[model samples]
Target: MNRRRIAVVTGSRAEYGLLAGLMRLLAADPRIELQVVVTGMHLEPRFGHTIEAIERDGFAIAARVPILEDGDSELASARSVGRAVIGLAEAFERLKPAMVVVLGDRTEILGAAQAAMLLRIPLAHIHGGEATEGAVDDMVRHAITKMAQLHFAAAEPYARRIIQMGEDPSRVHMTGAPGLDAIRDLRLKDAPELGAELGFPLEPGPLLLATYHPVTMDPTASVAGIEALLRALDRFPQARVIITGVNSDAGRDAVTGRIAAFSAGRANVLVKDSLGQVNYLSAMALAAAVVGNSSSGIIEAPALGVPTVNIGPRQGGRLRAASIIDCAEDDGAITDAIVRALDPAFRAGWPNPLSLYGQGDSAARIAAILAEAEPCLIKPFRDLGV
Candidate 1:
């Protein structure tokens, strides 16, 4: 019996967290061969050289496609995507994997999917049909959905959405969010340990684990939005604000600059390039409230029984848990939402675990499905509902 080779592409640190469990399961499966490709910010030193994290976890990296350049301009972002497309195409051609697995709505994933489509390799897409109307990622995600041969949606509603988008129902699987699987299974470090590791004192006041990324569609608003969020943070002087770095997108400089400016005099505020999944979840567990536009606050934070004050439009239309409080980019609204999120009454009514993303077995299910499913000829634009 020949081992079926599957290529998994991880572009950023966040996406890698989502894919790590699935990669581990695939690596352990006797019938499957996992080819991991690290790209985008994973190659950058500023992002904690996250490719080392991948290797540290004992998975062999099949390829590392360097696409990000120093400049944080729109042209640089576009060129990064183009370079990823070229590099990914060359990789897929050389490896000739049975399928290429791409996740989320990043530009690098879009480039990889396009490359796979052009190379005539079947594509397996994860987390499709979810809406993020705030950024260009929404468009990129939907485009990848159309190009993919197999879809693994996080929720039933998302699965239905993919079917509605003309994908064959049989080709789409509701495997829940793989990210949640890691969250559910992993034994996170204690608050003290996590704080020591992160080199920040764990104070008793409201702990805010915030992560903001550049909204590529609203390039001008990116810097302004970070400043607005910083202003909001200023209002919560008692709270310890822990901010993760921005994603590798256009205008990242603006986001980083604001963080640096805010951190200059604030002893309670700490900034990090990347927080590994374990530390991230540990922080979420201890946090009084999560404040940011990152999907983690929208999806994973709620599952941990933590309140999330989601600032701005980046994660607008996605399914949110009861713990999330949506707010605009305005500083006043963000500050008000933080107050609401930290309220005792609001924190008392947290949603149950089952109502959240998944049951924590998504990786096993995804691995089993990939192992058993026959590689059928995928016809583009075949409406399943029709």
Candidate 2:
């Protein structure tokens, strides 16, 4: 019998990290053929050329399309999307996969979704229904939902939202967040071991892991927000911070540059382009609190029982867990939030968000359903109350 070919496209280190467990599951299935098409920051030199890490993880990439250029302006970002669409269309034509899977709402992933739509390849979108009101991702995510035939929502509310958007309820599955799978399954290193792996010593006091990406909608918030976060971190003399670089988005250079300059001579601060998934999560597992506007702090941190000091408007309107301490973009506001996160009473009473998303079985469920379910190439919109 011929195996069903499923093309999985990933555009960034963060997105690939979320898809890693599902990709591994699909690859292990005898009836399924997995094709990983890598693009975006994975190919960019400044982003650490993470495609090598993908291969090192034992997955053979079927294609590499360079979409990221050497600029972070809106015009450059627009051109990269155009390039992604053209490159992805050709990849689909060559591979001729039964279906395509994509996660999240990066501009590059948006291009892949459009290519799948024009190619008439069934597109399965994961993490589709959450809202990030401060970023263009909210718009792009809903747009991708309309194009995708299958929706693997991380939460039930998210699945319902997809159906509310005129999609057939039967095609939407609450598969939980796949990133949480790594939290439950991976043998994360302890503080000392992680320190050795990262070649940075772990502070005995509170450790804060931060990753801030540009809010594409606001554009100006990222750099200012990160600077405020740094000022906030300055207030906690005993607190240590480890920052991961921003994504390849418009105005990202400013955020990355500021983070580099801020961490230059700070003994307690460490900055890296990428730490891969395992190492980054290991750091998260050991950190006293997580800071910044990345989705990991909003989704995965709560599941891991860690406190998150989510600053700025980047994550505004996203569902919040009890452990999340949302604050403004001001330096004083961020300082207060971090101080709250480190509080023993707050940490002790923080609620787990596992019920809001799901347990660690999302990857297996998503892989199995894709292997067994027929391709949904022509889904007619199902209106609400139908």
Candidate 3:
């Protein structure tokens, strides 16, 4: 009846929000000893030092590993990854967990996966086999899938992709996207309440919740894309905009700089470094349209029955619900997409949009699997006999 020690590594606010439900379940399970390892943006001040959010949620942080360099260039991202691998390896060595859990395709998460692999600790990867073609996440995600002994894909197509990647079929589970669990479980605040918390009025116009991240594959596009989005927002002068901070990716500084300039002295626009998880979901729940290239627009926004204007190729290859409108990273295209998302006819057309990921039960399933499943250091590649 000895409990298994499973360490979960989270490096960003978004990743932490998705992993929070699973972590809570793991911590509650009598047969599991949950170890929380905070790193990357969680340790960086510019990204809001979100490790405080984890501590506020009452989880004991087993380790704090600062792995980011001082810049947002490609070289900085590479150096950060290098630092992450070494720092996370040392932390894993101290925790000595039976398995390590990671979510998504961030470079820091990749480092954690590598560290776990080199240390011979079985790894469990969530959101595996998904693609973000415009960013380097596509490569990092698949790499982690290959390294992991247990794979929890967010959807059937993703599970199939993981199997196609030569992972053992038995090890892959379609647990849905843990992001949706927050939408289902949390009592989302109403528009007025959310507005009060955000220090803005949600009324007098449509509310747009927007977030943008760097397209690491094209560094120059980050600034240009944010500029286009800002221009598009200008077309809707009456709309209230909430632009969240950029992630700590390559070219992040450029995007953040552009957003800051755009929001400055604009009474209709608000910029926030971190809204945490609750306020974010509340805003999404009440938004006229979720506008951005962030995956939350694809996964969580549609699940909340909110239309998403997903700009550019950043989210290419992920499953798209009818509620999502894909557009190029141009002001004209983005503005048109936002227009469609706000049309009452368009919103009514897809009432109760089917969630392709799952029914918000991902965390429980993932927690149960981790509690009972045996972790192996070696996984023989499964071929399709092709």
Candidate 4:
């Protein structure tokens, strides 16, 4: 019997981290053939040439699509997406897999979904139906949910949200998060090794792991918002912060500049271009709290029983575990949240064994479903009856 062919698209280091386990499971399964497509920041040097990380893990790269140029302006980003659409369409036609899998709300993923739609290929979307009102990702995620034939939601509410969006309930599955699956099966690196790899030392006292990205819809807010976060961290004299670089977005340069300036003579702060999954998860394990607008604080931090201080509109409406504390973009509010997160009493009360997003076996479940499901031909938008 011929094996089923499944293509997974990854645009950045973060998306690739979440999809890594799923790719491995599909690759190892005797009944499925995995086709990995790399694009977006993975091809950029500033993001640490993330494609090398993927290849280092032994997964085969079936195609490499270069969609993003050195364009950070809004029009430039849109043009990049247009270019990606053409490249992805050609690649999908050549590969012709039974289904294309895309994760999260990055524009590149959306471009891939659009390509798959135009080519009449089935799309399997992960992390859909969750809201992120702070940025345009909320809209992109929902749009992909509608375009997708199969939905693997991270949490139950997310799964229900997909159904509420007029998706066939039978087609949506609560598969938790593939990122959490890595935490379950993989042993994290030690703090010293992690620090050395990222070219920083792990300081004593409470730790704050921060990752911020530009809000594509509100680029102006990026700089001020990050400034507020840095000022808030300044109030915590006993705490050390580890800052990860921003994504390749419109206002990313501004945010990166602010982070560089803030980390300049501070012995308590370390900023890095990127930290692979191992170091990232290890940092999460060691940190007293995570402070940033990144989705990792909302989705992955809860699984580790760590407190997450989610700042600003970037992750505005996403479902979060009890471990997260949402604060507005104000230095005072962020400082208060950090103080509260470090309180032992407050940390003890945080909900553990929280399965808001499934039980970490999402990869196996997603793969099993994909292996058994039949692909459907794409229909007209009018036929969708939305």
Using lDDT, give the best candidate's number: 3
Off by over 4 Å in 1: 384-386
- Give Cα distance to truth, residue 61, candidate 2, Å: 1.2
TM-score of candidate 1 versus the correct structure, residues matched by position? 0.97
**What's the lDDT for all of these models?**
0.88, 0.89, 0.92, 0.86
What ranges in model 3 sit over 4 Å off? none
Off by over 4 Å in 4: 378-386
- Candidate 3 Cα lDDT to native: 0.92
lDDT of 1: 0.88
Instruction: Give the candidates in order of TM-score, highest first.
Output: 3, 2, 1, 4
What TM-score, to 2 decimals, does candidate 2 have? 0.98
Q: What digit string (tens of lDDT, one per residue) describes model 2 on residues 157-274? A: 8988999898888899999999889888888888888888887888686888988888788887777887888888888778778999898889998988888888989998889899
Q: Which rank order by lDDT, best down to worst?
A: 3, 2, 1, 4
TM-score of model 3 vs. true structure = 0.98
The deviation in Å at residue 255 for candidate 2 is 0.8
Q: Indicate the worst ten consecutive residues by lDDT in candidate 3.
A: 347-356
Better of 3 and 4 by lDDT: 3
Candidate 2 stretches with Cα past 4 Å from truth are 352-355
Query: How well does each candidate superpose onto the true structure, as a TM-score?
Result: 0.97, 0.98, 0.98, 0.95
Per-residue C-alpha lDDT of model 3 across residues 1-386, encoded as one tens digit per residue: 88899999999999999999999999999999999999999987888989999999999999999999988888999999999999999999999999999999999999999999999999999999998899999999999999999999999999999999999999999999999999989988998888888789989879999998888888888888989999999899899999998998889878988898888889999999999999999989889999989999999998998999999889999999989999999999999999999999997767464678898999999998999898788788788976
Best by TM-score: 3
Q: lDDT of model 1 at residue 285?
A: 86
